[model samples]
Target: MIVVQNLIDAISLGSVYALAALGIGLIFSIMRLINFAHGELIMVGGFVIYALAGNPMLVMALSAIIVVTILALGMERLAFRPLRKASPPTLLIASFAVSYFVQHVILMIFGSRPMGVDFLSVLGESFEFAGLRVPRLQCIAIVVTLALMVGLVVFFRASRIGVQMRAAAEDFTMARLLGVKADRVIAVAFALSGILASFVSLYLVAQTGTVSYKMGVNMVLIAFVASVIGGMGSLTGAALGGFIVGIVSVSLQAYLPEELRPYRDAFVFLLFIAFLLWRPQGLLVRRASERV
Candidate 1:
């Protein structure tokens, strides 16, 4: 029963990582650059909710999403858009700089102390299923994450804008030639990525019960690893990678020898390295002729 509970916890945790990785992977697919500041965007979302804790829960959630969206758009316009023609290295460095800048700005405004919301306490009041105790917030997290993932898949598969975004990710030059408005598609990708980050921030806040200004820094690293392990541009791969990593991490913490727990991250990275050496294209690479 403990094992089963751990598995469930891992799934819930993995769902959040998957969503965060998807956001990271989506922008990379279109822009071919990792936004180092992506995690800060998520951190900002958490801070927004923390700031708005006195408001109704629904309003706080909406405001968090709105704040993240605006921040993402602002970053795109001010930092990324100007560097469109710059070298990849330049763009990467700029991303890192922006990330640092945002972190310091948050510190200046909110201080370095951790902040939290009471929503989880309100939402987590007694829930049980089949002899297993479960928090209501966890249930909500699972449901909301699944719903967002499904909505994203449908958007990419059926909507015209989604099609255009996919086309842009697959081949920006071709998309531009086909009058797909590459810039608009790129902007939409960032916007959607921001929304995903906001969703993740919400889940993390509920699960952890506290939010630090630096909460997203470590998470960004994990999400990046998840994206790379899953396949850089494949959303499905990112999701799969998240589940794998979550399960492995939790299992190691729960079952590994005490002396080995500290080395769990090393083991995970070794596995990642092995995967890269053996399958550099990733476990779920799209064929050249296939549209991801």
Candidate 2:
């Protein structure tokens, strides 16, 4: 029973990470830029919820999504667009600047204190059935993640914009030359990323019961690593890598000797190093011809 519970918790956490990586993977696929400011979208959504106090759940969610999406679009426009032709190192450095700027902005306004995420209190409940204990949030997180993943797959497979995005992911310059609209696809990518960030915001708040500017930082850090491990441009690989990271993290916490628990992260990074040495191309990758 304890083992089952740990598995459930690990899957829940992995689903959260996978969603985050999907966002990063989406933009990187098309633009080849890793937006470290992705975490800011999560932070913005959570803070929106905090600012709204006790608004209707659906209303709060949509409003927050819109706010985050606009900011994401603005980021691409104001910060990234001008540097479209720049080197990867330059884009990455700009992203770092964007991340620090946003984090400090939030810190300046909200201060360093963590805000209470008392909304969505019901997900915080736990239950037992058939002698098995489980968190409601865990169950909900898994279901939501599965549904969102399926929906995304369908969107990419069936929608016109989705096709263009996939084409862009394969080779942005070629896609544009083929008459696919670059701006539209990239905008949609950022919009989808923002939506995922909002979902992460909700799930994180449910899990932690508090919102801090730093909250998204660590989660996005994990997502970024998972993206690399899974293959930088492979969405499916990113998802799989996220699950592995989450499982390893939870397993270490659950089974580690208490005295060594503080070093769990060190162990996780050791695993990361092993992956780097063994399969730096990642667990899954598109054919060289298909990759961006």
Candidate 3:
């Protein structure tokens, strides 16, 4: 039973990471650009929900989604569009600029102190069953992640836009040549990413019970690492990598000695290094051949 509870904890944590990683992977598939500012969208969504307190959960959630989606679209147009032809390094710097800019804006408005939101308090409730206890939030996290993942798979398989997205993922240049509107597709990708960020923020805020301006920094980092570990451009691999990261993270937290627990992140990186050395190309991405 102890082992079973641990497993549940790991999965619950992993599911959240997977959701964030999927959002990161979606944009990478189309644009080949890592939007470092992605977490800002999450933070923005959280703030929106925080500001609109006392509203129904459904209302706040929808508001967050709508506002973040608009911000994401604007980000693509203003920050990314002009740089479509620039070098990756240039785009990367731009992402950093956007991230810092958003962070400061939030700080200026919300101040340094974290704000509280209990809109989803029901999820914090826990129950015991089969000699084990679990929070309602944990179960919801797992279910939400599973449902979103399955829905994404189905969308990609059955929907027209989804097919275009997969095509872009496989070969953006060729797909564009075949008449895929690169800008439109990229915009759609960002919009989807924003929606995912909102969902991530919702779950994260519910679990942690507080929100701060820089709260998304760590999450975006984990999502980026998960993307790399899973394979740079493989959405499925990204999700897998998130699960790996989450399980390892929780396991370390659960079993590490009290003194060593503080350094668990360092230990997680060690495991990451070992995994990379074993499979540097990642779980699914093909290694590009060197050409003379």
**Which ranges of candidate 3 are over 4 A from the true structure?**
286-292
Candidate 2 Cα RMSD after full superposition onto the native fold (Å): 1.6
| Candidate No. with top lDDT | 3
In terms of lDDT, the poorest run of 10 residues in model 1 is: 283-292
Q: Tens digits of per-residue lDDT for model 3 on 1-292?
A: 9889989999998898998898888887777788899999989988998998899999988998899899989999999999988877888899899999989999999999999987698988888999999999999989989998999899889988888888888888777889888888888889989888888988878887788888889999999889889998889999999998998998999899999999999999898889888988788784321110
Cα TM-score of candidate 1: 0.93
Colliding residue pairs in candidate 3? none
Q: Which stretches of candidate 2 lie over 4 Å from their true place?
A: 287-292
Q: Candidate 1 local accuracy as lDDT?
A: 0.83
Model 1 lDDT per residue over 1-292, tens place: 7878788778877778888888888888878778879999889989988888878888988999999988998899899998887777888899999999999999999899997676556666647777777677767777887898899999999999999987777777787889888668878988998999998888777667787889888778888989888888788888888877888788877888999999988888888888889988876775221121
Q: What local lDDT score does residue 286 receive in model 2, on the 0 to 100 scale?
A: 68
List the candidates' TM-scores in order. 0.93, 0.96, 0.96
What digit string (tens of lDDT, one per residue) describes model 2 on residues 150-234? 9999999999999888888888878888998877888899889988888898888767878898988988899988898999888
Q: Rank by lDDT, descending?
A: 3, 2, 1
Better of 1 and 3 by TM-score: 3
